[model samples]
Target chain A: MLVTKWVHVPEKAINKPRQIEQDGVKFTQSISPWDLPQQFRFLIDAESLTIEWRYLSDSEPVKRKEFPDGFAVELGKTSSRIYKITVSLSALEKSISVMPTDEAEAATSALIKMKNALAEIENYPNENNKVAMTKTAHWWANLPNKAELLANAM
Target chain B: MLRTSLAVYGWLNWVARGYQRASSYIASSCGFFLLIDTEKSEFLSTRPVITKFVQEIQSNMFILFCLFLFLAVIAHILTKKTSLDVWKEIKFILDRYQEKCFPNNKEKDLHRVTLFRLEKHCLFRRHWSSRNWLNFRGHCRLFSNFLVPVLRSGHINGKSNTFFQVGSDQNYEGVAGLAFRQKSQVAVKNLPDLSSPLMAKVKDRKRLITEYALQTNCKRELIEKWVELGKTVPRSIAATPVEVNGQIWGVLVLDSTSPETLSSESVSDYTVVIAVIGKLLERM
Candidate 1:
């Protein structure tokens, strides 16, 4: 069975697996092509008709679409499975379709793993922790009830 | 336009006569005409001559002019409306034929629904059928009640040959096949190839020649060379590319049941249809 995930990232960033360490929490981000197997990783920009697909262990991306604009990609009976940590900074939508022959217990275990990973990451603080603090301090300086908060705390 | 408008007006007037009054009026008029016009008219000549000679009161000329106008009005009205009625009947029959050919379409209603996404798509629908398909071009119509489907599916064979089916009929069992090449990608649809195991294969010399000619994009030299070969050996021909919007999409291959089966005019019409289809596919 193949699963599917569509992730939208900043245009400046290349989509790939990455590890980040912040606030005593470890997070990993990754994506697989929606079509074909995981072994065949393709980055398709359909408007320019440019396709870059490569097999595992191959350093060079094979260009296929060739045209300057993008075209629609036909998966031709293949699906994708993706794993990533749930974070506020990035957007992700994932879907999974299991094969008819897949064992129920195996599918459940994979779902559990995904759920645990999401729960762990959701509890972690945002990467830009200083921005929150600076905004709060700036707002407090202009507040009419500023004395009240200090009085209640004291 | 005037004739058409008048015909429509007359029909409206006839229908609005409330059935009761129109029937009685028609019956009474017929009875009066029958009584007066039945006898051999020896008195009619003298009556008309006397009426004609009267200087200030020429009733015969006035009556004759009125009768002429009435006949003209009636003839014009009946002809235009009758043709429209016949055309409506034809459209209904064609729609039914399309429904039967492509039955029970749920999601897209593609067979019936019009897709106005692209100007090219609209142009394709406007020009995609041969004049032979229509039944009323001076009575030279073929397939009076047949629904022709557009080419939407195709297959590329192992030998790099393409076969396609077009027109509403999916099972175009033994029809002329058109083969074209698109950047080395062969797409065959709209017709079944005779050489394929799936269809009825017959040895037709003229058709093969035409197929070769079309594959070569109707080049006169290539066609003449093949014709001079004495029709004994089948020759392999290369397709010349057709350019649209500054790009050479592919070469169009056309074939019919027989070589001279379609006239030059028919071929021209078919070419226009193919060009329209190509533009539609390009947009998609």
Candidate 2:
């Protein structure tokens, strides 16, 4: 069965300071819509390998454009913002399906490592000492089982 | 209706009788000898000759009147039928196009243009119209000075009858259909197909879309600022993607609402419609 996963990585690990690249792809934890201060929910389809971005405040969700293969998203200077690198691709595909048994587990582990890296950055008062600190703090805390939730097989 | 028809027929008959009398006088002027034989002068008198001529004249007049009346009625009926058919065709096109443009009941929320210049110019008021160019130029200047900046920068200050001129040389004039972008957001809650099953499964999708669109706008503004050394103020969504020499300068995002009546397929169908709009903009 085709499976999908979402991983969160810290900005420092993937940014110029640490600058880590794996398999021609860079990873980072960006202040994306997924990290908004408000509580949001998403529905995932493992069979089709898709993520449906929905909101609790609103009635419905929208599809985040298919994640770029070689691009990366990292937290911007502002706590409420995210910066994503533009990546060139052959064609626009709806979903990138992977084997559930091996690939899914690896993706989960990668996301957990990124989440831990972000936690270290969040510990430093200087890194987050900005006008939007409270907003960013809540954003980090709401990642429900941040590690385990990366790739739910169902 | 029946009574009126009978009265008209009676009046026509009376007029025909008068015409017969006039014809008889002319026949008599030629002398009674030519009309009757001298031997049977008493039996074939002036009365019988006059009566025959009068009958012939009346019969001809009656036939001609009936033919003219029939033609007039048929012409009137045909004209009415064709006009109604034309109106139906125009209405169908407008309604279908409106659905594609404003699918979410958002059309209802669209405030009417109070500005005289933008109030849906009549077919008669176009440039092709013989109206004075001085008036058109005056309105264009006024719109540029006041409404253009407000709409482009997303500011909402204006009274009733706000107008904006767009395009190089200010060839197009648009009126403020809504008050402000902030208030306009309230109506944007139901964006037709974006909220449908295909999109609804994603969490925080709407927020992401909104933020993404706004961030892109900000980035464009930042680039414009770098070039001009001034806050590259966007005059309006109309000003986005300003083309010069066949190149796209930026992209503009406009807000719309959901009316709930249109099907999801119609929303995706908008790509075709919007593409046509882009082409028209390029031409402009």
Best by TM-score: 2
How well is each residue in B1-284 modelled by candidate 2, as lDDT tens digits?
22234345446545554555454564454344344453355643657766566445554654645754564454444434342343233223324545444544443323111111122222222221113765654333332322222111111211222233334243332212111111110011222233335434455544533432242222222232222342222211211121112222122223232233332223223323323333333333
Given the true complex, what DockQ would model 1 score? 0.02
Per-model C-alpha RMSD: 24.7, 22.8
lDDT per residue as tens, model 1, A79-111: 111211111111112222232212122222222
Count of residue pairs whose backbone atoms collide, per candidate: 25, 21
Q: Work out the TM-score per prediction.
A: 0.18, 0.21
The regions of model 2 sitting more than 4 angstroms off are A1-154, B1-87, B96-170, B175-284
> In model 1, what lDDT does residue B48 have?
68
- Native-to-model Cα distance after best TM-score fit, residue B49 in candidate 1, in Å: 32
Give the per-residue Cα lDDT of candidate 2 at B127: 26
Cα distance off (Å), candidate 2, residue B69? 6.0
- Report the lDDT tens digits of candidate 1 across residue range B61-107: 45644764565465555544443453333333334433433345332
